[model samples]
Target: MLRELLADTIMQSAQLAERPEITTPPPGVSAHFSTAVAMRLAKQEKKSPMEVAAAIASKVQENAPFGLFLAVEVAAPGFINLTLTPDAHRGVLAEIREGGERYPAIPRKGGRTIVEFLSANVAKPLHVGHLRNAVLGDSLSRILEASGEEVVRWNYLGDWGTQFGKLIVAWRRWGQEEELQKNPIAHLVALYVRFHKEAEKDSSLEEEARSEFRKLEEGDAENRHLWERFRAMTIRGIDAFLVRLEIPPFDEDKGEAFFEGDITPLIAELQERGFAKESEGALIVPLDAYNLPPGMIRKSDGGSLYLTRDIANLRYRLDKYSPQRILYVIGNEQSLAMEQLFAIAAMLKLDSAQLRHVKYGLVLGESGKKFSTREGNTVAAEEILDEAQRRAVNIVNE
Candidate 1:
């Protein structure tokens, strides 16, 4: 914002056709801002840079607002350095006070936006990767809101999938009600990890997991109750983490399982409209036009995939909230999946709202590799904050 104000001042002072570049002075510069536009103009105007700098600085000081610039000095190498007056500093503080909880920004008046992030699976603790996603998404939403967009923070949780079945199987085998009550998320993660370890030895465990999920899909009462319980427990743990991180509750939190009943009709509509075709016993939408591999709607076993549920979610969003834009904060590993999702949306003509995948890089550890556990990205995000707090308290004590 100060840059914009400075650019305007320079444009008026020099009678330039365009605004000059205003940049922050480096450390130890003893100035708030600096610009080298005089040097740039010297090349074209055939004048010495010092002369141009002096002329602009004099003109700027002459016409500057009262109490705006304490000093506008011409530095060597044709730079114009500006130091702000106390009044200018007070004005910035006033604006920040007025903005309050919202992030301060020059308003763009952009339309409504829905940012979806931290869609962690229901079967595990939020990992370090998810922590970055949460922080980035929350910051972006605040920024977007400050820029005059009606921001809606949505966390489209991953509450549905076959892995949940494995978690259920493991839960039945070893889960204790009292132990799970103490810390459900950690217990869930341990169960999920143990399920894989046990399945490695007994291959039949995989089928059993699938059968459990099939029962879930068929709306078996016991399985449905377990699914609901697991979903609720996971949400409570996520809420505790949010409180620790100082992030407010999300505006919307409709998990993938919320669209379970919608996925079947969605696939039917795609097939009925000729957008989907059977490929090797799986329902898929051909994305050859976009140079992407076909997007799978349903697996050969008649289960819904991520993209399928995502389309259902988007369709619901468009029909209900009708946000002008939707952003997905996910890792770069899902770039191809996002592209396929977007392409299929285009094919289906779901063009009411913009769809974006805000891809992020992996969070690395001291070893310069991705921070992950043997169970794959199960390094609990809450532990990172706890460790940092512990170190901070240790330093304070010392």
Candidate 2:
């Protein structure tokens, strides 16, 4: 309101001086008003900038129509500064008190946005690395919604992949029903860590894991049932952690497996459009024209990779939600992969939806190294929250 008043006063003074081209000063807190319009007018009128400023200031003070300013003065060469009356400040505060929560509202014309974050794989527990992703993504979604944007908080879980294959193998070998009943997520992480250790000792374990995963993918009843149980347990664990942290529930919890059937058709369409080509035994999209490395969609083993699943998932999202933009809150390490994905999407002529990768720096331990679950050098998200709660309790008692 103060800004509007100042602008109107400046504009009126300019019109009265017959200098309609003179621009009004923008409202600022550092000074009530300041503009170089006087200097520009002086240049055209063949007079000193200070002289023009004085003439404008005198005219504005004489009118003083609103009487909302303590003083309006010409400073230095051609600057105009206005000090608001004390009543103006009091009035602004009273208005804010009356308005309460709806004091300020900004409207956005853009359509709905999908914010994807905290996409942790079900093979492990939520770690310190995921904390940053969750906090940043959730905060951004809240801010966008507050600014009048329609937001979809998406949790794109990494429930499908080779890691799941290894996890299945480990769980079948070492998983005990009693331990799982006690703590599902912890038991699963232990199994996952053990698998890596055992696979290191017996290289053939890697092939076995792959085979088991393939069985799951091929609709083997036992493997499918086990996978479903693990998925459910992991989701339950995630929900508990979110509740502990006071984070809101996700709008969508779709995983990569949800789009498994879409991969074939998506790849076929890419190939039909001349975007995909056979490179060696794998299917790849050549990005030489874009000065980027080729993006591999399928491996020599005829297995689809992350790129393939991502493309299919993007297609599904565009078709289902028809969002104006898709924001992926991920680490900086995946910047190249994201670039390649967007490039392939563009080549496929899927340019209607905007794709954004909101990359953040890695969260490192005190040793200046990245936190890794596989390396067993990471802090669990639950532990961090527990420690914070403990400290708060101590403070309350004090």
Candidate 3:
């Protein structure tokens, strides 16, 4: 409105002086109407810029065309500054009141958006690192929803992988059923930690863990049951912590296992499209064109990798939701992997959906080291929240 008023005044002033009509204000003119156009006009008319500004200001004040400006002053060096009127402010308030919550929302032109986050492995507890992922993703999802975009808050659980096989082996060998029943998540974490420790001492355990994981992948009944029980228990524990943190419920809690079936066919399709190739008895999508390393879809041991499941997940999401945007709220370290994944998606002609990796920095401990479960220096999400609550209570008591 201010720009329109300034444009009209400039045009009328030019006509009055029998000069070339100024249709638009200079580039420096903002929504607040700060313009150096008067100086340029003065040079063209052989008059002082201040004199020309005063003339334009006088014409605008007399006409009071839109009554938008409370004051239009000719500042030093012929700069015009406009102050919006109380009436204009009142009008904005009225419009805001009429629109209510929708007043400042973005138009709902874009389609749905899927925000995938927190994706912690079921074999471990929700740690401090997961907190960063959760907070960033949850906040972004809420903001998108508030801005009038339909958002699907998704938690892509790391429920399938080689770690699960190691976890299964650890559970079968040393896991006490009674202890697991008493406290599932803590017991699971202990099993995971113990597995790594044992693997470090006896290297063959690594291959054994891999074999167990392959069994889980190959539809071994007992291993599948164990994995499902572990996943369910971990999710319940995660939910309890999420409630403490006030993170809203997820719209979908689809694990990597949900898209496991999609991997084999997707790999074949990629191979057929010449996007994938056999390299060292494994299938990989060459990302050399994108300046990234090849994305491994399958290992030499017939093991499906995260990239394989992710490709399947992407295809599934594109087919089911048809979202305009898919956001992966992952760590900065996975930037290269995400770039490679999206590049492969493009190679397969899956370029319709916008893929983004919202990367965040690490959440370091007080000692300035990255949190790690293997190091036994990691803090659980629940413990952090409990400490925060304790501090808050202390402050309230004081």
Best by lDDT: 1
What RMSD value applies to candidate 3? Answer: 6.2
Q: Which ten residues in a row have the lowest lDDT in candidate 2?
A: 16-25
Residues 58-158, model 1: lDDT tens digits: 98998877788999999888999999998899998887788777635556675889999888777577888888999999998877877789888898888
Backbone clashes in model 2, listed as residue pairs: none
Model 3 over residues 64-148: C-alpha lDDT tens digits? Answer: 5575778877876986666667888788778778876545656775779999999977868788889888989988987887788
TM-score of model 1 vs. true structure = 0.83
Candidate 3, lDDT over the whole model: 0.81
Order of candidates by TM-score, top first? Answer: 1, 2, 3
Query: All candidates' TM-scores?
Result: 0.83, 0.77, 0.74
How many angstroms is residue 54 displaced in model 2 relative to the true structure, after the best TM-score fit?
12
Q: Score residue 311 of candidate 3 by CA lDDT.
A: 83
- Model 3 is weakest, by summed lDDT over 10 consecutive residues, at 16-25
lDDT of 2 by residue, 1-398 (tens): 44555666776855645333323455553454455667778888899988988887777777666656678777777876667677877887888788664454557657789999999788578988888889999888877877778888899999888887888889889999999999988888888888898888999989998999899889999989888998999888889878876778999999999989988888898889888899889999999988899999989899998889988888878888899899999999999899999998888766778999999998889899987666667788888888988999999999
User: Residue 15 in candidate 3 has what lDDT?
Assistant: 49
Top-scoring candidate (TM-score): 1
